[model samples]
Target: MADITIRLYIGPSSSDLRELVVPAERPLGDLIIDWKKVYLLAEQDSQGEMIRYQLYRESEGKKVPVDPKKSLRDLRFQAYQELFLTDACHPWWQGTTSQPTTTSQSKAPGTAPLRGPATSKRVTTATTPNPSPSSRPLPSFSPCSIELAPGCVRQIGETGVVINRDYLLRELPKSVSTLERTLMWMRQESRLLAVSRSDNGHCSIVWKQSWYLMAHHPVYISGTKYSRNEAIQIEETVTLLLGRDGWPITIRLHSTSITR
Candidate 1:
């Protein structure tokens, strides 16, 4: 994999941001090792080597810790993506030299376990500010997204809106939004190569994430019934192409699937 340059945040503030080029194939843990080499606080404390660090990134409006075992490529990280390689014991945030200690326990509830060793010195770190509700760009398209099916008690994202990610869109929010989210869901679930929507609202979801998905004729797609519009009959089994895992990735259902 080629190297990718990402915006790296060392401290909680914007000034701590830096552009760093990292190997796209390297595990995230490598960044922590590199951090120890530069951060002054990485030096051995009185009790020997002490102080821990971790990488975190913004996710759905929260600063979530990234799995150090995962590589940048595994995460489908985009070049513009930013990362938080934070130092929890930096002098700007540190307030004690009392006693150096080593333990996996978190000083307080609801905090990540210390990476290295630390003393009893307790300090609150600055939290990244939450983005404004309207921070997302306004859409410019025919809106179409998922919504509660009449009276069905569906838990937020449990619907097909989010086949993979834990996010949900409004019912009939935007068709583009549904298409984007559906593609993402397919990618994580199987070897999805492509997605193409017909003239109707129903989409052709073809992926290698399943074995042989042989349904009866007039199969229900996106909750709408559809029959074969092609020459293929109900007795025929249409094959979806390009199988790395196996067959059954392509489909030819057409207009009948959409509710006029």
Candidate 2:
């Protein structure tokens, strides 16, 4: 069997994305350890308490907690999938298992811009009628969504941007930069969500879906919903794009396997 590919966005921001390649049979716990090493997170207990990490998979527009024991293939994680990594201790993280525990003086390397998510709890004090202000839950952050720019979307060379098909096909002017080709490739792979090009011409694509296409030569039909004609057209476009030379691009391709 071959390996699988997935992308990890350090946070809600698109700027902190990183691609990871690992064995398809690898356990999620091992993947987490790899992340810790890459980010230089300390394994030693934080403060005086033991620190635990939780993994999450962003699916159907929701953050689904992942079990460390499950393998990537066991979880049915498709290629080009994206996952979010956050400390389970964050005040805003809904996955909190208990009261927040403080970490050691040395913070994790990939510090979040702010505390994230939201959840609630009830505390009873012998004499107090109201929960103290400090005990209240933090406000929820913006719901996770794809971040796209307005007008002709410019592609960041290292981290290619995702755009809607309608915008890419009609609104986006032909350009030499990575945007046009990136958009074309995304559309071919069914990663580009189609939307009306409004005054701003700005729209959101499934971030996880976008990164998957960039990392893998997608073959499975489950990752996308497309008509037979659309699929054929996409293949044709891909052929045309690959036929021409001097495009000056580098992308990773992953192996494939059939699940039982």
The candidate that wins on TM-score is 2
What TM-score does candidate 2 reach?
Answer: 0.35
In the range 1-260, model 1's lDDT, one tens digit per residue, is 69988877554344455778889988776566555545533323223322345677768855577877798898888896777664443322233222111222223322222333444233444553323325833322221222222232232111112221122233323563466468666775422232222332122221111111222223342233333321111112233322223112223222222221
Native-to-model Cα distance after best TM-score fit, residue 104 in candidate 1, in Å = 34
Please give the CA lDDT of all the candidate structures.
0.40, 0.40
Cα error, candidate 2, residue 107 (Å): 16
Tens-place lDDT digits, model 2, residues 1-260: 66888887554434446677878887776666567556744332222212245577767756777877788899888897876665554312332322122222322322322222222222223443444556755432211212122343333322333333354454344552346557666765322332323342222211211122221122222223222111111110121111112111122222332222
Please give each candidate's TM-score. 0.34, 0.35
**C-alpha-based local distance difference test score of model 2:** 0.40
* Superposition error at 174 for model 2 (Å): 81
